[model samples]
Target: MNTQSYMTSYEILVYTGDKRGAGTDSNVSITLFSKNGKQTGKIPLKNSNNKDPFERKQVDKFCVKGDYIGELTKLHIEHDNSGRSSGWFLDKIVVTDIFDPKTQYVATCNQWLAKDEGDRKISRDLTLHKQQTTTQKSNYYKVTVYTGNKSGAGTNSDVSLTLYGNLGEAGPMKLANQEDNFEPGKKDEFTIECQNVGELNQIFIAHNNKGLSAAWFLDSIVIEDLYAMHTYQFPCHRWLAKNEDDGKIARFLVPQSSTTETPQIRKHNQYKVTVFTGNKSGAGTDADVFITLFGNQGQTGQIKLDNEKDNFETGQKDEFIVECPAVGEINKILIEHNNKGLSSGWFLDRILIEDTQGHRTYEFPCNRWLAKDEDDKQIARYLVPRPKVKNNQYKVTVFTGNKSGAGTDADVFITLFGNQGQTGQIKLDNEKDNFETGQKDEFIVECPAVGEINKILIEHNNKGLSS
Candidate 1:
């Protein structure tokens, strides 16, 4: 036998005949011997429980530690002495390596009827078995990359990635050119189809080197199996620039649980406003500028820029810090200037608003003049709050079946919709949630604010059945 086969485990099948006529118990033993005639291990086969003439029995998963350098050459069987009437018969014997599917028929004997036939012994030659090569199953994965939110700096058309697995390495897959050129605050996905490639271990990202502005600020990457639903997220909070010494960034694809918790609203009580005055047209320097911030709950009082120090002078810029006492999200901002006469209005360039608490910034650009007959310059921008840690709680009772009828045996899904346009869904299994016929289950759902839940929709595996 080869080294691999000798070191592996085996299963032996034996057949023993009934010795009822013989008084003593019918004992059968099969012994193994190396090429040098050294006795190795012995396997005692179980006797037949049935009183039939000949019965076949099997001994599964028998193992023997063999010297890898040597091979087994001989096989011997010994039967205990019986009464004077007759002797036990050895119907057959077969050996198979459990690990080797190709070497299933290691040794076989049709009928080596072993009995004291006038004190004569019978022996049969055994042939060694060889092992065969086998192949393993392959796995597939899908990788998704998300770019960061940096204004015109690191957003480019060329984003490449290299995936490494147990089998081998797979490509420097390039991301397709998107409308935004895979720019900041953009996302793109790539698929990796491989055969016999094990779990994804590491990935290397390369940014575009076409130009200095072609670099990317990568946010995160999500890798998931094509068949499996779980996703692994790798957060990269750094810039991938070709000009840097180390242009490529490598990260381990660590598995992470998907979150279903509600995202918290960002609080922007402290605000910083940077006002840029003057436009390319070179108009309106004498008019006073007025600005107002409107939030979800309330609005900031009208702020006027009348003083010469804070006036909207040509090609001049100023900064202001305003704090809001209201406890809601900022939704809109209005910018207007007094249109007393020609050249009396201000030419607006742009306004930058920063939320100190959330570390979020927004720019409202207006290139035209804020003068007479111009529409009220209202920029309707929604400043979504940063996800805050949730503390509010809710209790939900799911009815598998009511008094009217019982639901079918299937999984149940529930979705909670909030007044703020936030929604969350959870799945419940029939057996896990104890959703038997006419049974109800209660669950505690955690959210950022309990009062935001406007309604809940429940659905079952059955089609078209939802409330």
Candidate 2:
């Protein structure tokens, strides 16, 4: 158990000016400073969520880690005018503590980070609110690098890694903890400040290809982003030695979410709900529709389903995505429409729900009319999952040849054979005669599907009299 995991996190919201060309493609950097002279490294600011970032009127969410730096008093921001139209107009910056949202610091820097802008300077230092106080502290990150056990797995070269995420990148941070840092079949741990890299994605690890054992077999790298409370795993399991692995001294390893990896705690979960309408006539509805899901733990608030130019049409599957707090095993769903009066019912065939966090799918079948004048006259219904069949009910049809004595008077039975197994012999009984000449008889039987129907066997008791 690491006590560093309990450190608080700060959220930075950057607003791009609404003016045209206010967005920038250039690299942006920032540093946090306390009035007591404590300051963080110049952390690179990049948002992975936005491919074309810093767009006009856009707000980017980033998490910044603070090392004991209490009551932030100011921050230094700068951007390199690199890419096309890289001029960036600076709006106000709002920083808040994740643990205490009410504790906020507003730095209003209405300037530009462009060569041709106001001061022709690409950097500015903005102070916090006039009423706030400041102090000094620094955040720490625990980095563990593993050396492979293979022959000549250790490296004598200098190893460095840069943390990349939506918030920023902190590094090329040298991995020079001790003289025997990269020893084969060994692990080294070092604690450094990797101030908030929101949603850690990719990591760049490499060596300078120096020393006696410059070619090293790297196993993996693990970094703790206590600000986001996630331990990210960047598995290499390859050679970073120049003479090995395509003779490359560096490897860009992305984060893995395998069973061994610890995922970041998510505040909200997204659900994809698809409502299928019956193919029958008058199956669609014009009024707004809503649904509420009930699970073992709790229930979701009523959410409206609306998408596309037209939705909930006859013989159509209307899909909608909604985000809410995670719930337990889903058991039931409530679906209804606001439409009343004549012929306004919606014939819902079923509803399918998929939960990404739980990796479970739920199906609720309601093959009926949801109208005020139909069924039970109730427009709403609570439908539980009626599928995921443990046993399949198949309607078997038997045709009697149109010839003399073609009908079977004796008790008839059938055993269906499939790839999985075979079903027990089931009696084929009906309301009318068992089977008449030129007549087709249908019977329903329930059994586990043997997979593919390869063959079937039929038998009779040969009892010619009534029971």
Off by over 4 Å in 2: 1-138, 258-467
Compared with the true structure, all predictions reach lDDT values of 0.52, 0.74
Reference-based TM-score of each model: 0.26, 0.31
| Regions of candidate 1 where Cα sits further than 4 Å from its true position | 1-139, 177-181, 243-467
Error (Å) of candidate 2 at residue 49 is: 31
Candidate 1: residue 427 Cα off by (Å): 56
Write candidate 2's Cα lDDT for 300-342 as tens digits. 5555576655888899988887755455777888898778434
Against the true structure, whose TM-score is highest? Answer: 2
Please report the candidate that would top lDDT against the real structure.
2
lDDT of 1: 0.52
**For residue 434, what is the lDDT in candidate 1?**
56
